[model samples]
Target: MNDYLKNGLFLAAGVAIGALGAVALGKGKFSIRPAMADLLSHGMDLKEKTATVLERAKENLDDLMAEAKHAKESREGKSVAEGETA
Candidate 1:
Protein backbone atom coordinates (compact mmCIF):
# COMPACT_ATOMS: atom_id res chain seq x y z
CA MET A 1 0.00 0.00 0.00
CA ASN A 2 2.68 2.44 1.06
CA ASP A 3 5.27 3.51 -1.50
CA TYR A 4 8.16 2.88 0.93
CA LEU A 5 6.86 -0.61 1.75
CA LYS A 6 6.50 -1.49 -1.92
CA ASN A 7 9.98 -0.19 -2.72
CA GLY A 8 11.49 -2.06 0.24
CA LEU A 9 9.86 -5.32 -0.85
CA PHE A 10 11.15 -4.84 -4.40
CA LEU A 11 14.68 -4.19 -3.16
CA ALA A 12 14.57 -7.29 -0.96
CA ALA A 13 13.38 -9.45 -3.84
CA GLY A 14 16.19 -8.15 -6.03
CA VAL A 15 18.80 -8.99 -3.38
CA ALA A 16 17.35 -12.51 -2.98
CA ILE A 17 17.48 -13.11 -6.71
CA GLY A 18 21.08 -11.87 -6.91
CA ALA A 19 22.17 -14.13 -4.08
CA LEU A 20 20.53 -17.13 -5.72
CA GLY A 21 22.24 -16.33 -8.99
CA ALA A 22 25.64 -16.11 -7.29
CA VAL A 23 25.17 -19.50 -5.66
CA ALA A 24 24.03 -21.04 -8.92
CA LEU A 25 27.06 -19.64 -10.74
CA GLY A 26 29.34 -20.78 -7.95
CA LYS A 27 28.22 -24.37 -8.50
CA GLY A 28 29.73 -24.35 -12.03
CA LYS A 29 32.95 -22.37 -12.47
CA PHE A 30 33.23 -20.30 -9.30
CA SER A 31 34.51 -21.68 -6.04
CA ILE A 32 33.27 -19.69 -3.09
CA ARG A 33 35.25 -21.68 -0.50
CA PRO A 34 38.77 -20.56 -1.37
CA ALA A 35 37.76 -16.95 -1.57
CA MET A 36 35.90 -17.20 1.69
CA ALA A 37 38.87 -19.03 3.24
CA ASP A 38 41.23 -16.26 2.20
CA LEU A 39 38.93 -13.74 3.76
CA LEU A 40 38.61 -15.91 6.84
CA SER A 41 42.37 -16.14 7.16
CA HIS A 42 42.42 -12.35 7.47
CA GLY A 43 39.81 -12.54 10.22
CA MET A 44 42.40 -11.65 12.88
CA ASP A 45 43.55 -8.64 10.96
CA LEU A 46 39.96 -7.53 10.50
CA LYS A 47 39.25 -8.05 14.18
CA GLU A 48 42.34 -6.15 15.29
CA LYS A 49 41.66 -3.26 12.92
CA THR A 50 38.03 -3.07 13.99
CA ALA A 51 39.01 -3.09 17.65
CA THR A 52 41.59 -0.37 17.12
CA VAL A 53 39.10 1.81 15.24
CA LEU A 54 36.42 1.33 17.88
CA GLU A 55 38.87 2.08 20.70
CA ARG A 56 40.02 5.27 19.04
CA ALA A 57 36.42 6.31 18.38
CA LYS A 58 35.50 5.61 22.01
CA GLU A 59 38.49 7.56 23.32
CA ASN A 60 37.68 10.51 21.07
CA LEU A 61 34.04 10.41 22.07
CA ASP A 62 34.98 10.29 25.75
CA ASP A 63 37.30 13.25 25.34
CA LEU A 64 34.64 15.24 23.49
CA MET A 65 32.01 14.41 26.07
CA ALA A 66 34.35 15.45 28.85
CA GLU A 67 34.98 18.77 27.09
CA ALA A 68 31.26 19.30 26.60
CA LYS A 69 30.62 18.56 30.26
CA HIS A 70 33.31 21.05 31.30
CA ALA A 71 31.79 23.70 29.03
CA LYS A 72 28.31 23.08 30.46
CA GLU A 73 29.66 23.30 34.01
CA SER A 74 31.48 26.51 33.21
CA ARG A 75 28.28 28.04 31.86
CA GLU A 76 26.32 26.91 34.88
CA GLY A 77 29.09 27.89 37.30
CA LYS A 78 29.02 31.49 35.97
CA SER A 79 25.44 31.92 37.15
CA VAL A 80 26.28 30.50 40.61
CA ALA A 81 29.36 32.71 40.86
CA GLU A 82 27.23 35.78 40.09
CA GLY A 83 25.09 35.18 43.22
CA GLU A 84 22.19 33.72 41.25
CA THR A 85 20.55 30.67 42.91
CA ALA A 86 18.97 28.40 40.30
Candidate 2:
Protein backbone atom coordinates (compact mmCIF):
# COMPACT_ATOMS: atom_id res chain seq x y z
CA MET A 1 0.00 0.00 0.00
CA ASN A 2 1.03 3.63 -0.51
CA ASP A 3 2.27 5.65 2.51
CA TYR A 4 -0.39 8.30 1.99
CA LEU A 5 -3.10 5.70 1.84
CA LYS A 6 -1.86 4.11 5.08
CA ASN A 7 -1.82 7.47 6.83
CA GLY A 8 -5.35 8.27 5.70
CA LEU A 9 -6.61 4.91 6.83
CA PHE A 10 -5.09 5.36 10.28
CA LEU A 11 -6.55 8.83 10.62
CA ALA A 12 -10.01 7.57 9.70
CA ALA A 13 -9.77 4.71 12.17
CA GLY A 14 -8.73 7.06 14.94
CA VAL A 15 -11.62 9.43 14.26
CA ALA A 16 -14.10 6.56 14.20
CA ILE A 17 -12.79 5.20 17.47
CA GLY A 18 -12.94 8.62 19.12
CA ALA A 19 -16.51 9.25 17.88
CA LEU A 20 -17.71 5.88 19.16
CA GLY A 21 -16.04 6.39 22.51
CA ALA A 22 -17.63 9.80 22.89
CA VAL A 23 -21.07 8.44 22.04
CA ALA A 24 -20.72 5.63 24.54
CA LEU A 25 -19.54 7.97 27.25
CA GLY A 26 -22.35 10.42 26.53
CA LYS A 27 -24.95 7.69 26.94
CA GLY A 28 -23.79 6.88 30.44
CA LYS A 29 -24.31 8.85 33.67
CA PHE A 30 -20.70 8.57 34.73
CA SER A 31 -19.80 11.31 37.22
CA ILE A 32 -16.14 11.44 37.97
CA ARG A 33 -16.55 13.80 40.96
CA PRO A 34 -18.15 11.22 43.22
CA ALA A 35 -15.61 8.58 42.21
CA MET A 36 -12.70 10.88 42.96
CA ALA A 37 -14.25 11.96 46.25
CA ASP A 38 -14.63 8.36 47.35
CA LEU A 39 -11.04 7.61 46.38
CA LEU A 40 -9.74 10.60 48.36
CA SER A 41 -11.84 9.67 51.36
CA HIS A 42 -10.42 6.17 51.35
CA GLY A 43 -6.91 7.58 50.91
CA MET A 44 -7.35 9.78 53.99
CA ASP A 45 -8.58 6.84 56.03
CA LEU A 46 -5.60 4.77 54.95
CA LYS A 47 -3.24 7.60 55.83
CA GLU A 48 -4.69 7.83 59.32
CA LYS A 49 -4.40 4.10 59.86
CA THR A 50 -0.81 4.04 58.61
CA ALA A 51 0.17 6.88 60.94
CA THR A 52 -1.34 5.05 63.89
CA VAL A 53 0.56 1.86 63.03
CA LEU A 54 3.84 3.72 62.59
CA GLU A 55 3.42 5.53 65.91
CA ARG A 56 2.81 2.28 67.77
CA ALA A 57 5.84 0.70 66.13
CA LYS A 58 8.01 3.66 67.13
CA GLU A 59 6.89 3.33 70.74
CA ASN A 60 7.64 -0.41 70.81
CA LEU A 61 11.07 0.17 69.24
CA ASP A 62 11.89 2.85 71.83
CA ASP A 63 10.99 0.51 74.68
CA LEU A 64 13.10 -2.28 73.19
CA MET A 65 16.09 0.05 72.79
CA ALA A 66 15.81 1.23 76.40
CA GLU A 67 15.73 -2.34 77.67
CA ALA A 68 18.76 -3.25 75.54
CA LYS A 69 20.76 -0.33 76.89
CA HIS A 70 19.89 -1.22 80.48
CA ALA A 71 20.92 -4.82 79.89
CA LYS A 72 24.28 -3.69 78.47
CA GLU A 73 24.94 -1.49 81.50
CA SER A 74 24.09 -4.34 83.89
CA ARG A 75 26.55 -6.65 82.08
CA GLU A 76 29.29 -4.01 82.30
CA GLY A 77 28.71 -3.61 86.02
CA LYS A 78 28.99 -7.37 86.58
CA SER A 79 32.27 -7.57 84.57
CA VAL A 80 33.78 -4.69 86.61
CA ALA A 81 32.96 -6.42 89.90
CA GLU A 82 34.54 -9.68 88.70
CA GLY A 83 37.70 -7.82 87.61
CA GLU A 84 38.03 -6.13 91.02
CA THR A 85 37.89 -9.51 92.82
CA ALA A 86 40.73 -10.81 90.64
Candidate 3:
Protein backbone atom coordinates (compact mmCIF):
# COMPACT_ATOMS: atom_id res chain seq x y z
CA MET A 1 0.00 0.00 0.00
CA ASN A 2 2.98 2.30 0.57
CA ASP A 3 4.12 4.50 -2.34
CA TYR A 4 7.68 3.21 -2.04
CA LEU A 5 6.51 -0.39 -2.11
CA LYS A 6 4.36 0.22 -5.17
CA ASN A 7 7.22 1.84 -7.01
CA GLY A 8 9.59 -0.98 -6.11
CA LEU A 9 7.08 -3.56 -7.29
CA PHE A 10 6.63 -1.72 -10.58
CA LEU A 11 10.36 -1.56 -11.13
CA ALA A 12 10.77 -5.22 -10.30
CA ALA A 13 7.96 -6.23 -12.68
CA GLY A 14 9.46 -4.15 -15.46
CA VAL A 15 12.88 -5.72 -14.98
CA ALA A 16 11.43 -9.23 -14.90
CA ILE A 17 9.40 -8.69 -18.04
CA GLY A 18 12.29 -7.09 -19.87
CA ALA A 19 14.63 -9.91 -18.90
CA LEU A 20 12.13 -12.49 -20.09
CA GLY A 21 11.59 -10.73 -23.39
CA ALA A 22 15.33 -10.40 -23.97
CA VAL A 23 15.80 -14.09 -23.36
CA ALA A 24 12.91 -15.00 -25.66
CA LEU A 25 14.36 -12.98 -28.52
CA GLY A 26 17.95 -14.09 -27.88
CA LYS A 27 17.87 -16.92 -30.39
CA GLY A 28 15.24 -17.13 -33.12
CA LYS A 29 14.37 -16.03 -36.62
CA PHE A 30 12.33 -13.22 -35.02
CA SER A 31 15.17 -11.95 -32.88
CA ILE A 32 15.46 -8.19 -32.75
CA ARG A 33 18.08 -6.68 -35.02
CA PRO A 34 20.03 -3.45 -34.51
CA ALA A 35 18.25 -0.09 -34.26
CA MET A 36 19.07 0.72 -37.89
CA ALA A 37 16.42 -1.63 -39.26
CA ASP A 38 13.70 -0.08 -37.12
CA LEU A 39 14.80 3.47 -37.83
CA LEU A 40 14.95 2.95 -41.58
CA SER A 41 11.64 1.10 -41.73
CA HIS A 42 9.53 3.11 -39.27
CA GLY A 43 10.89 6.58 -39.94
CA MET A 44 10.12 8.86 -42.95
CA ASP A 45 7.59 7.70 -45.60
CA LEU A 46 5.12 10.19 -47.06
CA LYS A 47 6.16 10.45 -50.73
CA GLU A 48 8.65 7.57 -50.51
CA LYS A 49 6.06 5.18 -49.11
CA THR A 50 3.59 5.85 -51.91
CA ALA A 51 6.12 5.21 -54.65
CA THR A 52 7.49 2.12 -52.87
CA VAL A 53 3.99 0.72 -52.47
CA LEU A 54 3.07 1.39 -56.09
CA GLU A 55 6.26 -0.31 -57.30
CA ARG A 56 5.52 -3.31 -55.13
CA ALA A 57 1.95 -3.34 -56.43
CA LYS A 58 3.15 -3.41 -60.02
CA GLU A 59 5.51 -6.28 -59.21
CA ASN A 60 2.75 -8.20 -57.44
CA LEU A 61 0.37 -7.75 -60.38
CA ASP A 62 3.03 -9.02 -62.79
CA ASP A 63 3.52 -12.07 -60.58
CA LEU A 64 -0.22 -12.67 -60.47
CA MET A 65 -0.51 -12.50 -64.25
CA ALA A 66 2.33 -15.00 -64.60
CA GLU A 67 0.48 -17.32 -62.23
CA ALA A 68 -2.71 -16.95 -64.24
CA LYS A 69 -0.90 -17.81 -67.45
CA HIS A 70 0.59 -20.90 -65.79
CA ALA A 71 -2.83 -21.96 -64.58
CA LYS A 72 -4.42 -21.45 -67.97
CA GLU A 73 -1.77 -23.56 -69.60
CA SER A 74 -2.15 -26.32 -67.00
CA ARG A 75 -5.93 -26.68 -67.37
CA GLU A 76 -6.90 -29.89 -69.25
CA GLY A 77 -10.61 -29.20 -69.85
CA LYS A 78 -12.17 -27.24 -72.71
CA SER A 79 -10.30 -24.11 -73.77
CA VAL A 80 -11.82 -21.19 -71.86
CA ALA A 81 -10.74 -18.59 -74.43
CA GLU A 82 -11.74 -20.75 -77.42
CA GLY A 83 -9.46 -19.45 -80.21
CA GLU A 84 -6.65 -18.07 -78.02
CA THR A 85 -3.36 -19.87 -78.81
CA ALA A 86 -1.49 -21.61 -76.05
Candidate 4:
Protein backbone atom coordinates (compact mmCIF):
# COMPACT_ATOMS: atom_id res chain seq x y z
CA MET A 1 0.00 0.00 0.00
CA ASN A 2 2.79 2.47 0.86
CA ASP A 3 4.69 1.65 -2.31
CA TYR A 4 1.61 2.21 -4.42
CA LEU A 5 1.07 5.63 -2.91
CA LYS A 6 4.66 6.62 -3.61
CA ASN A 7 4.44 5.47 -7.21
CA GLY A 8 1.18 7.36 -7.71
CA LEU A 9 2.75 10.56 -6.42
CA PHE A 10 5.72 10.16 -8.72
CA LEU A 11 3.46 9.63 -11.71
CA ALA A 12 1.45 12.72 -10.87
CA ALA A 13 4.62 14.80 -10.57
CA GLY A 14 5.86 13.58 -13.95
CA VAL A 15 2.56 14.47 -15.62
CA ALA A 16 2.64 17.95 -14.12
CA ILE A 17 6.15 18.60 -15.30
CA GLY A 18 5.41 17.28 -18.77
CA ALA A 19 2.36 19.52 -19.04
CA LEU A 20 4.37 22.54 -17.96
CA GLY A 21 7.11 21.79 -20.47
CA ALA A 22 4.59 21.44 -23.25
CA VAL A 23 3.04 24.78 -22.38
CA ALA A 24 6.42 26.48 -22.31
CA LEU A 25 7.37 25.02 -25.65
CA GLY A 26 4.07 26.02 -27.19
CA LYS A 27 4.71 29.63 -26.15
CA GLY A 28 8.30 29.57 -27.48
CA LYS A 29 9.60 30.58 -24.05
CA PHE A 30 12.01 27.64 -24.05
CA SER A 31 13.93 25.93 -26.84
CA ILE A 32 16.18 22.86 -27.03
CA ARG A 33 17.54 23.49 -30.55
CA PRO A 34 20.27 25.89 -29.52
CA ALA A 35 21.34 23.63 -26.69
CA MET A 36 21.48 20.63 -29.04
CA ALA A 37 23.53 22.60 -31.56
CA ASP A 38 26.04 23.64 -28.91
CA LEU A 39 26.34 20.05 -27.74
CA LEU A 40 26.99 18.87 -31.31
CA SER A 41 29.57 21.61 -31.86
CA HIS A 42 31.49 20.55 -28.77
CA GLY A 43 31.28 16.91 -29.85
CA MET A 44 32.75 17.76 -33.26
CA ASP A 45 35.62 19.65 -31.67
CA LEU A 46 36.42 16.74 -29.39
CA LYS A 47 36.38 14.31 -32.33
CA GLU A 48 38.82 16.45 -34.33
CA LYS A 49 41.20 16.76 -31.39
CA THR A 50 41.11 13.00 -30.80
CA ALA A 51 41.86 12.30 -34.46
CA THR A 52 44.86 14.65 -34.47
CA VAL A 53 46.32 13.09 -31.33
CA LEU A 54 45.95 9.58 -32.77
CA GLU A 55 47.70 10.56 -36.01
CA ARG A 56 50.63 12.02 -34.12
CA ALA A 57 50.92 8.92 -31.97
CA LYS A 58 50.92 6.69 -35.06
CA GLU A 59 53.72 8.75 -36.68
CA ASN A 60 55.82 8.56 -33.52
CA LEU A 61 55.36 4.78 -33.38
CA ASP A 62 56.45 4.43 -36.98
CA ASP A 63 59.62 6.45 -36.35
CA LEU A 64 60.52 4.33 -33.33
CA MET A 65 60.00 1.10 -35.31
CA ALA A 66 62.29 2.31 -38.10
CA GLU A 67 65.03 3.21 -35.65
CA ALA A 68 64.81 -0.20 -33.97
CA LYS A 69 65.06 -2.00 -37.29
CA HIS A 70 68.16 -0.01 -38.29
CA ALA A 71 69.82 -0.77 -34.92
CA LYS A 72 69.18 -4.53 -35.35
CA GLU A 73 70.67 -4.57 -38.88
CA SER A 74 73.76 -2.70 -37.70
CA ARG A 75 74.35 -5.22 -34.88
CA GLU A 76 73.98 -8.17 -37.31
CA GLY A 77 76.47 -6.62 -39.79
CA LYS A 78 79.06 -6.01 -37.00
CA SER A 79 78.77 -9.63 -35.80
CA VAL A 80 79.22 -10.96 -39.37
CA ALA A 81 82.38 -8.84 -39.90
CA GLU A 82 83.90 -9.97 -36.59
CA GLY A 83 83.22 -13.62 -37.51
CA GLU A 84 84.95 -13.19 -40.88
CA THR A 85 88.06 -11.72 -39.23
CA ALA A 86 88.23 -14.66 -36.77
- Across 1-86, the per-residue lDDT of candidate 1 in tens digits comes to 99999999999999998899688776877666776679787997899999999999999999999999999999989978887653
lDDT values of the candidates?
Answer: 0.89, 0.92, 0.79, 0.93
Model 4 C-alpha RMSD vs. true structure (Å) is 10.9
lDDT of each residue in 19-76, candidate 4, tens digit only? 9867877899668778769988999999999999999999999999999999999999
Query: Positional deviation of 58 in candidate 1, in angstroms?
Result: 0.6
Worst 10 residues of 3 by lDDT: 76-85
Q: Between the candidate structures 2 and 3, which one is better when assessed by TM-score?
A: 2
Candidate 2 residue-wise lDDT, 1-86, digit = tens: 99999999999999998798687678886655676689889999999999999999999999999999999999999999999999
TM-score of 3: 0.35
Deviation (Å) of 17 in candidate 3: 49
How many residue pairs clash in model 2? 0
Clash pairs for candidate 1: none
Against the true structure, whose lDDT is highest?
4
Compared with the true structure, the alpha-carbon lDDT of candidate 1 equals 0.89
Report, for all candidates in order, the number of backbone clashes: 0, 0, 0, 0
**Weakest 10 consecutive residues of candidate 2 by summed lDDT:** 27-36
